[model samples]
Target: MIQSVRQTFNQAFSPEHYRAFLDKINADFPGQLDFRVAETPVFVPKVLTDKLLTACNDIVNVITRSDFKTLTEQAIPEGQRVPNEDDHTQFMAVDFAVCTDESGELTPQLIELQGFPSLYGFQPYLADQFRANYPIPENLSHLFSVANNAEYLERLRQMVVGDCNPEEVILLEIYPEQQKTRIDFTLTEKFLGVAAVCLTKIKKEGRALYYEKDGRTIRIRRIYNRLIFDDLQHYPDLKTDFYLTDDVDVEWIGHPNWFFRISKYTLPLLKSPYIPASYFLSDLTDYPADLENYVLKPLFSFAGSGVKLHITSTDLDAIPSEQRSGYLLQRKVTYEPVIQSPDGLVKSEIRMLFIWPKEDERPTLLTNLSRLSRGEMIGVNFNKNKDWVGGTVCFFEQ
Candidate 1:
């Protein structure tokens, strides 16, 4: 963290301004934001930024290896693999827990990485609101791959809605309206011109997809997919015309297969000081002696689902041997409480978001989403009645 930036931001922060900020967001899109927006942004110093970039490149190197796909073949559940997955994922998000090294200096430890999209649409808008209302230094930029917001949006447009009319490309989700991050859907349409279309409403005819818009039906040319394929299990009772695995005439931006191939499943393949020790539960012959220092995680779950922070040999043994492959045994990184909140210091988790065009060889880190937590981990359940704890953006020193 930049001490001067933090000091000035803290000095300029006011409850009234924060309230006004919330009011402005609500007024712009009433009742769309179900998640809390943290009161302040994280000011990341260049040293830590450089380290984070190194950690990212190390993991990306593994992801970009020639035999990466062959190694992760079993990652995709047998019946869940989608049709016509691309050569690579168009979007990727890597999470890091801010921690202190042995030398007592700030360092980023890899928590998890996903070849999936994050809040690519809303992060820049969130940064703008913070700058407009707060005393943020001009040198600190939230974007890296591009110069400004307009260029960033253009990059997204080229990747997500390329060659086709905006109406022909949809942000596919299970129920776009019901998702908590609907604010992003609204913003995506505003900037990218792609509308959020629900899966249930898709009309499929002879392997072609179409969705009803304002007055007529529009053929789908591309899918900026946001739907988690596993979520379809929740609505098994409901009938749908289009399924993810169905052979459809469309381009998939964030191909569903990469979500699993590059997840906790790939963690064991990475070798880096920033990446904590990770092993598939099914692959472990002998449990570590210090099981207390590790956490158990489901290989494919999101938003902190089925993650056991504190674990033991007994806990590991309880999982059926046949089902162990679905889980991951990961060394836990001690989160250093570093963000100076109003009442006390809070731990921060940074999710570095990247976008890779179809033609690009590697994904480009564009922006970030930082979460402040005072609880055991970063999520909604961890901090219920907490302030300065929730979704936020990071201003990296240029």
Candidate 2:
């Protein structure tokens, strides 16, 4: 964080401005935000930005393959496994811990990667609000190579919408307002001009899907999909038409397949200094004698639901042998909160956002989301009532 900007911003920061910020968000959208919005934005330094970009490239390389079709087919044994959970993971949130690499140099290493979505919509709006209310440095930016908010939106459109009219694309979610990440859906709708329609709201006829808007039925051409089928499994009673495997005519903004390809299961396959060494539960050559050093994670689960941190041999043994195949033993990389915390130093992980150009093979590092925590885990519940710890985007020096 730059001291000059911090000094200027702090001088201007007030309770009134904070109130206005919330009011502005409310005015911009008619309802509640899905995820928690922090009072301030995190300032990212140059070193961390470089490391994040490098980490992203390492991941993109593994996912972009000439023989991806064959590779994907081999990876999935059944029709259900085709998406590979982490495959068409449209939004890639690579969490990084600033750590010393093998050469003893400080570097950001991969802590985790999720197939889930983040605050793509709220970040730009929040960034603008931060600039309006605080004296952020001119050189620092929340927006990356794509210029300002409008350009960023266009880039996102290209990523998800392509040449299709924006009105035709819908940001699909399951009862979006009820989901924890509803704010993202709202933001995506606002910025991308895509409708945030739930699975229940979608109208189906033959093989087509449509949603009504302003007295008109807009044909669904593309889906900026945010629905998690895993959650769909929870509610077996509900009949929904937006099943990804249903052979719908619309193109997926974030292909469902990428979610399965680049996940905890694939982390073991990606070799990078920025990434922790991960082993398949089935393929682990030799289990660490000290199981305490690693965390056990199920291949497919969201928001740290199935992670067994502070792992023990007994904990690993308790898992049924049949179920063990679905998990991975990931070496724990200590995340040191180098960012100054108000009370004391707190650990932090930065989730780098990316957009893969349709023409370009690699996805470019765009903006970032940062999470601060005092507890061992980075979940919001773990850092409840904590200051400077919540859902926040980072403003990095360009």
Q: Supply every candidate's count of residue pairs whose N, Cα or C atoms clash at under 3 angstroms.
A: 0, 19
What TM-score against the true fold does each predicted structure earn? 0.98, 0.88
lDDT of 2 by residue, 1-398 (tens): 54565556556767677778778877877676655566667676677677777778887787676654455443332454422233234567677865556665557878777544567777787788778867777788887777788888877777777788889998887787787767677677767777788788788777788888898998998777677657777788997655657766676666666566556667776888778788878775467986788888888776788788887777777878777768889988877655554445556677887766545756676677877677778897787776666777778865
Among all windows of 10 consecutive residues in model 1, the one with the lowest summed lDDT is 229-238
Q: Give Cα-based local distance difference scores for all models.
A: 0.90, 0.71
Show model 2 residue runs off by greater than 4 Å: 1-20, 67-91, 99-106, 115-117
Give the C-alpha miss distance for residue 173 in model 2, angstroms: 0.5
**Model 2 clash tally?**
19
Candidate 2 local accuracy as lDDT? 0.71
- Among residues 3 or more apart in sequence or in different chains, the pairs in candidate 1 whose N, CA or C atoms overlap within 3 Å are none
TM-score of 2: 0.88
In TM-score terms, candidate 1 sits at 0.98
